[model samples]
Target: MRLLLVEDDEHVAAALLAVLKRHGFTAGLARNGAEAIEKTQAGGFDVVLLDLGLPDADGFEVYGQIRRLSRIPVIMVTARADVRSRIHGLNLGADDYVVKPYDTGELLARIHAVSRRAALDQASSDGPASGGTGGAPAPGGQVLTAGPVTVELSTRRVLVDGARVELTRKEFDLLALLAQRPGVVFRREQIISDVWRTSWEGTGRTLEVHVASLRSKLRRPELVETVRGVGYRLAVPPAL
Candidate 1:
């Protein structure tokens, strides 16, 4: 797999580069956000490891630039451990966030998880059923409508009452997953595994945070109901 590693710390970069190479990744290194942006535009990277405290720009800014250009998966690697930082990174379209001093093995796991999701996204994009031509519509291609909310599966766009709603990538994915199965209760574990394609490590609150953000953006807090002791379900009818 090809990966981009954007970090200004030489020592950390060297260590991570070796680890990634040892795991059969053709890793490219960028010392700053500017280079990261430049390299990304050059294409061919399957994933990006971004550091927030870049010399030229913040990681979030880099993330915005990348999102404007492509839907490539990004994992933020930063020393900041605050909840606000993590939330901000994820809200800016990062697939995941790893704090500095993280375990290399855990980082590898995250890379694998994000890579799997990217592959799924590509597969969904190429599925003939999703208007890819020459086949039936993809199961994921069905448009979801609930009251004033309209979610277009192919484009991953969420519209509320005809107005486009701005949502972070994670929020959009989470909302789409729930809306795809209205009234079908999904446990937090299931959501983590399905949406993130990874095992839950007692970090279900991340799902809750994204769900809350989705509700806020949808402007209908009651759209998603929390089942006590279980999980969450979209209030829309299944047949809708």
Candidate 2:
């Protein structure tokens, strides 16, 4: 996923950026509020990690500007952990808030959470005009085949080795999104946004749960390959 890390602390930003990159995310750094706003205006960002402490302007102000500019998901990553600050950020439309000195794992989760939500909201606004659920292929519209897995989009039906495999709404959406582009690694953010219709970081666990369920239901553990440290891809077994 593409991310804009808006932070002023060079050391902190550098460390976080390195870790984010190692985890397979493309991230850009903006040292101040102005830079953050400027970079966002350039577009192509999936989420913004905003630090409230900026030299030029208040983080809140920057956030407000960003909200006015675009609906991009923004997570407030700052040291302001007070109740009012958190409440205010939310009131200004911050998707999520994370206090400083937080576990990196948790921060990443929050980022994913907000992004997922934004994706879902975007899809909802599009109102099926995007021809898919949460940006997934429209049901009853087409059939996607990968190896022994056959996904009937129009019917939301799945058949493995010619036997029907019932799936939940999310399960079907997730599988269909992967099947649409077999062998390609779909980032967790993308999957959550497209399938769950939300880029919520917390949804990661839910996605994992759904994946496990899908594998069990399909009786094909190898059907969805996990790309370690990245995301997931469909593993279509070679023809026998």
Candidate 3:
């Protein structure tokens, strides 16, 4: 898989590049966050190894920007080994977090794992079935309605109580997933795996955040009900 190594340390970057080459993987180097973002925006890279300490911008900032700019997976390869930093990075949507002095084999394994997951996610999105459930898209522009809310699957739009409700891509996916089987509780792990398509354990909080955002955006706090340590389900069961 192609990788972008975003480390300012030349010695570290050079050594990692050699290792990557020996593994038959192509990689490009970015000395700072700006270069990393630029290279990422230019596309072609499959994954990114970001170091936190960048000259022009914080690696976290670059990471957030990259996620917003594209769906490419990013892994944090930094010396910030603190639990807080790891959680923070993962919560910000990183595919994986690898500390400094990580085993070369493990790093390569993580790279492959994230790439594979990304491929699966892309395939699912482009396949005949839409969203996490793998259900075929409804013909004639299917729409799901639950109480005051409505979801337009083909157009990726939502309306609540006859008013339009805007949603982010992730938010829309989460909503559509729950809408697939309203009143059928979806485990948090299932939600994370389906929406984010990564096995990283730190993404549970992201799931919670998205659920909450969906509630707020849909303008009905009780529209998505928490199942108390289990998961969430649409408050109103489906009719069609």
Candidate 4:
């Protein structure tokens, strides 16, 4: 897979480039936010590893620019580890974030996880024909029925045992992604990209935060199961 690495520190960039190359990734380097945005738009990279501190522009500004043009997955690599910075990055549509001095193994794992999730989402989007006028019943109209909960994609609505359940846009999107393939695990990075349409800016907690909000509104909170060390999946209840 091709990846864009944006960092001003020469040593850091060199080290990461070698590591990413060793992992069979075609890595592109950018020294500043402006170059990062430019290279990103010009190249078809599978993912982007961006640094928040850039000489030309703030990392957030670069993120905003990239998000405006493409939905390419992004992973933020920054020295800032504070909660506020992380949350702000996420709010601006970053997919994941990795603090400086991070382990190479962890970063590689994150990249693979995000990539896999992207592939799954693309498959789902391109799978069977979903939208069409009245005709034979469409299989894409399959409603995920989980006990008291029912999600209807055709109507973009959710109901708990027949009663409508109010949800924010992000919450609804997250639920729909999970309900699309019950029991299939989705990493936090995948959830953020597929549901939020943002690159991974290194904030996996965003998934937990949103999931907590979703569970609070769900009739059966247990329907969404946390798959320790992986991500989350919709639980399949016992047959009646």
Candidate 5:
């Protein structure tokens, strides 16, 4: 896959580029935010490995600019391990985040996962609409409903009480997985395997954070129930 590596440190960039090349990936390097934006505008890369420590500008600002330019998947690779920073990056619509001192195996796995997701999302978007209307359609996708909440997999849209609810990619994936089998408790490991598609130490916490975010955005804390010493399950809503 073609990847854009945005890092100001030459040493770090060199080491990473070598590893990436060995893995059969064609990668281009960008030392600063402006160059990153310029490359993103040119639009040939499949994914971007963005570092927060940019010599010219803030990485977050660069990320915003790149988003405005292209829909290429971006994975934040930095040393900022704090929850606040990670959440901020994810909130900015990043495909994933990898803290520094990371394992090469995990990094490669994340890259593949992000790229796969982007491809699927793109395919869904380019697909035909349902019912001869202008709305998105899912040939094999299902429209799941629980109470006042509706999830359209084809368009990746969510509606709560007839009001649109904006959700991050991960949030939507978590919700959709549970919505598919309401009241069925999904094991923590199982959830991670299915949603994140990677086995990592931080995935459990990430799942908890995503669940919290989903509850807050859906404005229904009771919608998702956490089983003691178990994982979680989507609560079946009462009939209106």
Candidate 6:
């Protein structure tokens, strides 16, 4: 894969470049946020390894610029291991966040995982209007609604109470999954396997975080009901 390494530290970048090369990846280096954005605009990299501490601008700003330009997956590599930073990065369109002092093995794994997810998204976008075959189709209509929130599967759009609501990738997926069959409880394991394509053992917290974020974004926390030891269900509000 052609990868972009956006880091100002030469020694760190050199080491990562060597590791990526040894893993049979074609990699390019960007020393700051501007250069990274410029290279991304030029169009070549498959995935971006972005460092938040940039010389010209904050990596988050660079991430936003890239998002405006392309749908290429970006993984944030930074020293910020705080939950706030992690959530912010994901909220701003990062495919993954790798904290500093990360294991090379784990970083490689994240790179591959993010790339796979991006490829799947592209494939889904290019194919039918049905979207990913993760869960049931939105039965008879492209839009799925529960309470005041309406989700358009084909366009990946969400509107809450007549107002457009912006959701992160995972948050949308989670809501769409439950919204498919409102009032039916979906097991946690099933959710992880379907939405994240991973086991619940390590990704449970991520599921919870996404759920919380979804509730906050939709402004209807009660819409997605917790089923205690089981999982969660979408509470379809009674008709007016």
Who wins the TM-score comparison? Answer: 2
Model 6: how far residue 62 lies from native, Å: 1.1
TM-score to native of every candidate shown: 0.56, 0.69, 0.54, 0.55, 0.57, 0.56
lDDT of 2 at 197: 62
Any runs in candidate 1 off by more than 4 Å, and if so which?
Answer: 130-240
Model 6: per-residue Cα lDDT over 1-240, one tens digit each = 789999999999999999988765789999998899899999988999999999889889889999999888999999998999999999887899999999886687677667756654664555466444343343335666777878776667787787878999888888887775578776787787768877668898999989998888888889888999978989888897
Per residue, candidate 3 scores C-alpha lDDT tens digits across 66-179 of 888888999998888899999999999999999988988667667766765675465445545534323333444256666666776666767777777889999987887777
Q: Rank the candidates by lDDT, best first.
A: 5, 6, 2, 3, 1, 4
Instruction: List, residue by residue over 180-220, the lDDT tens digit for candidate 1.
Output: 44666666666777677667786687888888888888888
Error of 2 at 22 (Å): 1.4
If the candidates were sorted by their TM-score against the true structure, best first, what order would they fall in? Answer: 2, 5, 1, 6, 4, 3
Alpha-carbon local distance difference test for all models: 0.78, 0.81, 0.79, 0.77, 0.83, 0.82
lDDT of 3 at 26: 76
Tens-digit per-residue lDDT, 23-121, candidate 4: 557889999988888898896798999999999898888999999878888888899999999999988877788888898866876776566566555
Best candidate per lDDT, number?
Answer: 5
TM-score, candidate 4, is: 0.55
Stretches off by above 4 angstroms in model 5 are 130-240
